[model samples]
Structures are given as structure tokens and as C-alpha cells.
Target: MSDDVTQDAVLIFAKRLGEIIATCEVSAVWIDSREPCAWQYIRRDGETIIVTCKTLQYWAVRDAAARNGYRLDVKPDEMDVMPGQQITRGIPHADKLSTLAVTPYLSGNSETIFRSAWGDGSEYPTLRRMLRYASTADDLGRAGVIGKTAQEMYGGPLNSSSKVQRARDTGAKEWRALSASLDTARDELIYRSTRPQKDD
Candidate 1:
């Protein structure tokens, strides 16, 4: 989707979310039948700021800073950017969160964006998805080469729990072998880089 469309969706989503929260009130007194629920609001930075009735936390600090439109640094798939960051007061305005930076793709260069969006997952799959909208075939190919090289260097299938378990049981010998393979792959990519290759 276009950036405009995605942004519009986010705006609509934010408004709807705000409306939903406006109707809900938390009271621990009714915990016997209805447990006190924690409400989380997704700020423009894609950070979910949660309000816990037990602590009577209203996200005053984060909300106050965000109300003035501060740039938020958030991790991917995280509820809060700075977890355990405390808020001592109540936020006066809620709509200000709509202006915070949310989309990861909107900031940084291609490489930086790619790396940030990938998180700790398999780099190849992430690269493949990012390459879908690449401006040129060469760009996609280069990313593929990078992905393949990274995958091989990582000993492949890091996400496969079973494989990792098997590798772990092989102990010190396997670690040495895998480490050697990775070093070789790193050297190969580095050697190619020093020769001055096309960016694409």
C-alpha cells in the first residue's frame, strides 16, 4: 500500500482505539466478577503505553512528553519503547499521540531500515520481503546475495528449534566447526567488498 493509505489507516485506527478506551473505566472493587483490566494505547511511535488500574498509572510522563510531540524511539513488536519507564502523573490530552512517528519505513536509509525492521529473525526472509518493492532488479538481487550469505554464515535455520537443539547437543566440536564456517563466509564477503563492486 502507498504511504498515504497506510498513514490514513493508522489515523483511523488511532481514533477508533481512543474512542474504545474512553468508554472503559477500571475499578478493582468489581474484581470478584470482572477483573480490573489494563488498557494500552498505541502511540504514534507504535509504542503501546499501558495504564494499569492497580497502580493507578495513567501514563502521565510518557503522555505528557508525547503531547508536546517528542520523537519516540520504540522497538519493533514492543508495547513500550523504554520498558519500566515510569509515569507519575495523568495525561491531559490523548490525541497528541497521533502525531508521533509510527512507521519504521518512514525513517532511515534502505540498509538501516531493513536491519531495523528485521529484528532478530532470519535475515533472508526479511530481506526477501523488503526487496518486493525494490526499484530495480539489481537491488533485489544484491539483497538476495546478502541474504544468502548471511543465512549460510549463521549456520542456517536458526529459527528451527529442533535443529538448534541438535547442534547444541553436538557440543564444543560443532561450535568450533560452525565458528570456522562463519569466519570463512565473513572473509569472503569482506574480500569482495574491498574490490569495489557495484552498489546494486
Candidate 2:
């Protein structure tokens, strides 16, 4: 799909997702496409979830956090980006936290709810069902749903193999370098623009 189509899809998805998770305290939803072929959803709780249809394997949630100046505690290889799957990580609004207890819980719980409501299927139907489920579920039922999702995602082999880990490490290094270069270029542009100009 074209960029416009992809962005439109993401926006629509965000709207539906926001509605479904409204009770979960999702205050706002916005998309950032800093990485090509991938869209990152920035949440009000300082968590980020990234989605992409690209074939390349990326640590989507981590990269999104890194791009936004928040470093999550997860290893680079933990979560691989795949279509219809969201990688989520909680980040502090100001700086990295000394401990990761609450952030990970919030991030993991939110991710679980989303995956449960919208299992690997077409978007609209899944979301419609999810909304129905959320609308009727009490707090205890919602917690139960999240618990089931947590068990499923974390129960088995979420870990990458050695080879995959190596590749992820290399990709992370390259991504960091590129990000630093872009930051430098942006800083230079701002400096030049703000400097007092002399007569040519």
C-alpha cells in the first residue's frame, strides 16, 4: 500500500483501538512514522506501540522509544515486528526509570488486552467484537482477559535464537548511528538558522 493508505489505515485503527481501550486510561493517540513502513502509536501513559507490514525484522517498540528519547529496559531482540502485531513498551515522560516494575506491567497488560480483543484477523470485525467485549466486561473480567493474554504471550518461546539476536544487535547499532547523525544534522540546521547573519 502507498504511504497515504498506510497512514489512513493506522489512523482508523488508532481510533478504533482508542475506543476499545478507553476504560484502560488511554488519554490520547497519535501516529509517528519516523521509521519507514512502520507506524508508532504514542500513548498518554508514555508507552509506545509500533506496527508495520514490512518484511524486515525490527525491534519495533524499542526503536520507537529510542527515537523519542526514551530507552526502555527490554533487550533489542525481545520483540520482533510483524504485521497485525503490536510491540509495546512503557517509557517515562521525563527520563528512564530506575526500576521497570510498573511500566512493564502497564505495557504488557495493555498489549495483552489488545491482542486478545483483536486476534490475528481482519481489522474491522475484530475491533467491533473487541469493542463489544470491552463494553460489557467488568473490571474483573477485563483483568481476567489481560491475564489470559499475558500467559499466552509470555508462556512459551518469545526469545530469539542466537543468530537472530546477533542480527538484532547489528540492526540496533546501525539504527542508533543513523539517529545520531540525523540529530546532528538537525542541530546544525537550527544553529545556522539562529546565528546572526553578516552581509554577504
Candidate 3:
């Protein structure tokens, strides 16, 4: 068979396997990359099994299993460790662990931003400054600011055209209510500033 045909068959098989696993009551699924590339799926019954890969290390597999609340029956010594593979006792075996050839699919691009900020060593100070500014703002002002910021960040209200409009439509509730109080304070300050002082 040609390489393209083999790849298509593998893709189909993987999709079917994923569907089957999804239907099963699995507690967690862990992709183990230590020693032998493998996958470990722990069912709700606490039964744990490992799928071994010759080219990946299963070094962190134990920890991953524990984190997912699985307790494997086999001990470390029971693993058959070879140059590029590690096999656990009493589990189904595959001829080539074909899944290893599949590329990992990361869900987002946030890692690039995170790595860039970390590499430049600016994230810590930026976060600290933001925290300080937030702490210094008065409760009412802080709430208003945070609400406005969130509105802008998330494209206004979940169901409205804009957050400000949403606030007005909703009777200026919660943080928006503070706007009236602020206006009153400003008017009082202006009146006091313009008034003549009494003779001593």
C-alpha cells in the first residue's frame, strides 16, 4: 500500500478509537512521553493501564497516573526497559505503537505570549504594578474600572451592544450606581470651591 493510504487508514482508526474511549466512563486520560511514548487511561473504576512506546520515556507516567487518581498494580521494576521503549506487565500490546507518529495538538497560542514575556523577564513586574494600582483604587472606583475593563475585554455585555449601555438599561445597578454618587460629590466640590469665604 502507498504511504497516503496507510496514513488515511491510521487516521480512521484513531478517530474510531477516540470515539470508543469518549463513550467509556474514563476518569482521566494521560499522554505519557517518558522513555516510551504511551497513553494511560484511568477508568472511573480506578483501573489503570499503560500503552507503551519504544521512543518515549514513561518516567513521569507514574506521577501522571497518581494525579489522575489511578493506582497501577505493577511496580517500577516490573517494567521491561529497553533502549527506546518501556513495557509494563499485563496490558494489551501493539505491534508498533503507531500513535507515536501522530503530532501533538496544542489548543492555543497563549504559550507563545507567555514564553515571550517570561524570556524578557517582564511579566513579574507588570503583574506587580497592576496589583498595586488595583489595591490603591477606592472600592467604588475599582469596581467601576474592573467592570468597564471586563466589558471592553469581552466585547461588551454577553447579550448587549456595549457594557455601558447594558448598565444604563439595567437601571445603573451595582458598580454603575456609583456614577451618580461621584457626580454629586463633584458638584459639591465645585460649589465649595466657587463660594466666598466668611470673614473671620
Candidate 4:
């Protein structure tokens, strides 16, 4: 096979291997770039199975069976991994993993922003700081900031526009204040939902 084809095949196999391992609650995962294999120790039936990413599906199946002390014939052609009912492939694979590992209680542009902010290596003091940044232009530059920060850092997607509006409509400014004041600005966003307004 050509080098490009080989690489593509390897990538596909690696992702499928990830789905399988994650389903088993492996607890830890690491890819071996040197060997071009993804290996993990997954828990199955109250036991551990060390599975390897090899093109020889039979070998991987046999090894997993041996490790788990199970007797099942995992056919080479039929050994495929599916995650959460989605047959993820290519970009979808990475996207699925992103949802698994990264997505928090956020949606839309805010979720985008939060992840981008973290990628830049700034460690905010608390969840409050993270959410306060969301409404700012600075935070808007990042992708999924609101979604991730609220979902992962805070309890849920408090920074989301829809939730913010709900709080506002109910005159529950305290909720937004409680969330936003936790961080850098230390003040509720004036334009935020549920806050009383005066004509400019």
C-alpha cells in the first residue's frame, strides 16, 4: 500500500480501537506513535483485557479474550467498535472523542470560546473567573468557552444565552451574579439577562 493509504488505514484503526477501549472504561489511554498502535487495559466482566491496535483483527480479539478469560470467537472482519450508537469515522471520530473528553455544560460560540481560552494556557482561579470571561470580547474569540467552562468547570451551562434569558425573565439576577462574580471582573455583567435596566 502507498504511504498515504497506510497512514489513513492506521488512523481509522486507531480511532476504532479508542472506541472499544473507552466503552470498557479503560480509565487511562495512550497512543504509541512509534509503533503506530493504540493500546489500553479495559475492564470487562470484572476483569482486565489488554487490547492492542493491530491490523490483524484476529490477533487483537484473541489477545483480548485471553486477557479477559472469556471464550468467544471474535471474527476478524466483524471486530468493529461503535461508540454511543454512532459509527464515527474520520473527523467524526475526533469530534466524538472531543464530546467524550472535553464538552462540558455549554453550547454555541461560548463553548468554542472556553476551550480556546484553555488552549492558550491561562489557568483562571475559579469557575467564576471562567464565566466572567465568556461575555467579554476577549473570551468570545475562543471557541466553545461558555459551553466548556460552564459544563466542565461550573455545574452546568449557566453562561448560555438561553439560560441567561430564563433567569432574566424571572428577575433572578442573583443567579447570574452568583455565577459571574466568581471570577475576574467581580461584577455582574450589566447587559446580562434579568438585570434591571435604565435607558441609555
Stretches of candidate 4 above 4 Å error?
A: 1-15, 21-38, 59-200
Pairs in steric clash, model 1:
none
lDDT by residue (84-119, candidate 1, tens digit) is: 542223334443322222211122233444344444
Q: After TM-score superposition, what is the CA distance of residue 158 in candidate 2 from its true location, in Å? A: 18
Question: In angstroms, what RMSD does candidate 2 have relative to the true structure?
Answer: 23.4
Write down the lDDT that model 4 would get: 0.40
Model 2 residue 60 CA deviation in Å = 33
Estimate, for each residue in 56-151, the C-alpha lDDT of model 2 and write its tens digit.
Answer: 122333344445444456533434345543344444433223222233333434544444443453433322333444566677453433323323
Q: Output the worst ten-in-a-row residue range by lDDT, candidate 4.
A: 86-95
Each candidate structure's TM-score, on Cα atoms with residue i matched to residue i, is 0.17, 0.22, 0.18, 0.17
Clashes per candidate, residues 3 or more apart or on different chains = 0, 0, 11, 22
Highest lDDT: give the candidate number. Answer: 2
Q: Which parts of model 3 have CA positions greater than 4 angstroms off?
A: 1-72, 82-86, 89-107, 119-200
Candidate 3, 1-200: lDDT as tens digits: 22443444455556545654554343223345322233554445675443333211232343334344434466445334555334333333333323322222121223443343344434243333334446667874545544453354456454344655543344335324334444454445445645899999
Model 1, residue 174: what's the lDDT? 41
How far residue 44's Cα lies from its native spot in candidate 4, in Å, is 3.5
TM-score, ranked from best to worst: 2, 3, 1, 4
Model 3 vs. true fold: TM: 0.18
